[model samples]
Target: MSEGVSIFAVGDPAGAQLNAAIRRTLFVLGEERSEVWNGVLQAANALRWRRMTQPQPRQFQTQQPLIDDIVRQAKRLRNLVSDGALLDLIAEAAVAVGETDSPAGAVLLQSIEEVGTDGCVVVASKAAARAGLASWLDEIGATVLVPSELDTVASTAETSYVVAPPSFMPSSVVTAPMTPEVTFVMPAWFGNRSLPSSAFGGHAEGQIVIKSTVHTIGDTTEPETAVAEGKEVADVYFPQPVWGTRSSGEREPTSDEVEACKVLLAGGLGLWLDDGDRIRSLDPKQPEGARVGYEAVKGIVPGTYLVLRQGETERGAMYDRAVIALGARARGILATQARWKARLDERLQLIGSRRAMTELERLGVRSSGQVRAWADPRLICPQRDADFALLLDWIGEPSHPTYGNAITLRRAVYKASADLRKELESAVGRADLRALERDGILHLDLPREGFRGMIVARVLAKAPFTEIVSRHHVRVPFTDGSAQWLD
Candidate 1:
């Protein structure tokens, strides 16, 4: 909401901007010469943590095609990014767990079971804590993120498995077994899709969730015509058997279609959609009549199209990105507002309007944000105290959190590079220092004694902002008569 605060500003957080994060790892490795530097790194990582938690889309995602009756739809990979990275390993480094040799590591993969991909990355612990000659770091009992949080799609897939390192070999232990409820299989994406909830065998708990954008009030969602107006777009694949036929007849879900199959708006509510962008209702139900919570209205994707009348389109793509970035923060407001609106409407239907207005105003909660910020736990919730918490979780907020990076970059640099590379990195990055070097006021120097005792040796320094820009160094034994140091 501030100036220069657009999605583009999110910038690659994994870049040099994250130097502080790297330093924190270093500090944990027993490298500490400056406590002041540690404090700075702490704040920097906190900031990075925020942005890392924002609900951005996958950086690497392919299309989804599981329409064939033979190619039963399994869990998608795009939704795995939130699961964290997988551990990198080699066969030699493998260890045994619980008295078993060649211990197969486990992972906690999270996702919606069907949309996009999860970027929960697979990573090898760089830590030196090894069990033995067996690359101890790799062989230890650890939880690896299958797809890595770097991946956005893999985390949201319906069912995640605690797969072993090798793809072919079956592990002795798997989080999800071959049981019916353990494995989910959804219907086809397009072409006369029809199911009776009995079609998915026993795993009928799957529901296709969708966040549609609305234009007009009512329209048809027939796939036969180019602009088939649908008063509602029904993702009826969930809790029921339904088929969707395409206009051209060539069909394969891009990604969202497959995920939507596992979700159903509550009470058989229907959504109007043409290209996944919600239009309005078709079953002749008032806005107050529809369902509530994430089961009813999920969050929209990044590039959803609206008003596809062969010309203009909805510019909500930015809103989509912001919503994704703010994640549950934005969704919390929507869900709470929807639930509260339903409650208010119900109250109004029974009581006088004047009294309702007075009650809401008395609580200092005239808007959705106020409702979202309600820590009181005693608000007019539809259910119990955790109603607010549950609503936040549905929207991906009040649970997982992340923060902006650029605002914290400076602080991180100050922490990690108290006087090391960051200080020099900034020294080189700054215009004034660069000018000083050119004008002979400052010169990069490598002490004749090397890093053990080195200085920038100011020649004609004039900037009075020296409090933040000073230099110091220390050294420790490295090898025979040699040493390593950072200033």
Candidate 2:
């Protein structure tokens, strides 16, 4: 990439580094700015970037047990980090939707089914919009409306119900037998996971809507608490059961076991070992087949191990945090690219010359999809050459190592990020105005007021560079209103 590209310099993002990167990205995007800063700072202080200076013991009488313990600790750490990342994303999304209340757990089917009757106005914030809340309500026969649309349709509706954030609750409503009542659907960190498609009863027209939920004994209402109280954990995060080494004896895995592994991978779960540093595959169809051994599956708890080895099931979280982080990273990467492409379109429409537009159109580069067509790295545009070259290079095809062809979109993000360092570095350099802050005769860092003069000199320098850096950099905003950049 480039000499000082933060994205390249940073290695495989794990633990604090990955967490910090994500927090930075969200801060720059104007999503959960305060929350992200606080979270990043807290993580930094907590981790202290320590390293184990001791050398490893080469021999062990029962190496499997030691391996198992390390794995367990690793998994716990990974789960916490992944959970935090997902929650942050949800929180940021809630803010984007302008939710007046906490946006947690509002999209759960249970929450929707309780009130989603025909003609009932399901009031919700924009934060709930992306989680398929409206679609779920419609599936159960409810008239869904945003908080803003309630005023126009409130008087015309049959049964008035508001699903708004507490601040947006309609105060002028009556509370008689059938009057409007505000129901708060609090965000939850854990609950009964959505059942597999096959177990979701049937979607056939005229079939009775069977209200069924997968229940497990000793299951807590929240995942964080459940993870803390491990045995009491019940999370149905995986659509299919996880499978592992047969407890019966040494034998070849059945096709069913292999398929179960495939399902877990598809669901963003993977076998982790050696303190979450190594990933093991459940796929039995690989060149060496499935790598099922005592060491391979050691540190997993009994309930979770049974699910993997015997196909015995549980309804709780049984995933590595690294795996979750990878999935999140994949999604974040693609979303950033998509947003960048969109901004390019917006920029072109405003400033692109007629000839530039025509040339781009001739090459079928009007949109992001078309931008992918001109894949030859050496190709250059006669106009908007920088943007055209960037889109070609930035948009890439990435495939997951385990799932092969299954997760194309996720891999795209992974692959693009893999190759994005140079572009990001270039963008950062383009954005830097430190040179302007210093005298040509005596180069040095500028003071605060001098920096302001340089900034005023070129306001336009910020926009395009910011857009490009945002596609790759995580910018952590500070209390002083400045940001720390990371990849």
Q: Which candidate is the best by TM-score?
A: 2
The root-mean-square deviation over C-alpha atoms between each candidate and the true structure, in angstroms, is 30.4, 28.3
Candidate 2 yields a Cα-based lDDT of 0.27
List the lowest-lDDT window of 10 residues for candidate 1: 468-477
Clashes of each: 96, 14
Worst 10 residues of 2 by lDDT: 1-10
- Give the per-residue lDDT of model 1 (tens digit) for 1-487: 0111001111121311232222323333344233323222232332222222211122210001101110121112114322111111101011111112111110111222122133222222110001111122123332223222213323333332222111111221122122111111111111221112222335645542212121111122322212232322322211111222223233322211211211112111111222121221111111322211111122332111111111111122222333445545555544544444444344444543345345545544333323321222112232222443443433343332211221122233233223333233332333233233212222333222222221121111111111110011001101110000000
Across 355-452, the per-residue lDDT of candidate 2 in tens digits comes to 43455555555443223212211111212334344434333322223122223433443443333323323322444222221101111122322121
TM-score, each model?
Answer: 0.14, 0.21
Residue 11, candidate 2: alpha-carbon lDDT: 15
Residue 340 deviation, candidate 1, in Å?
Answer: 53
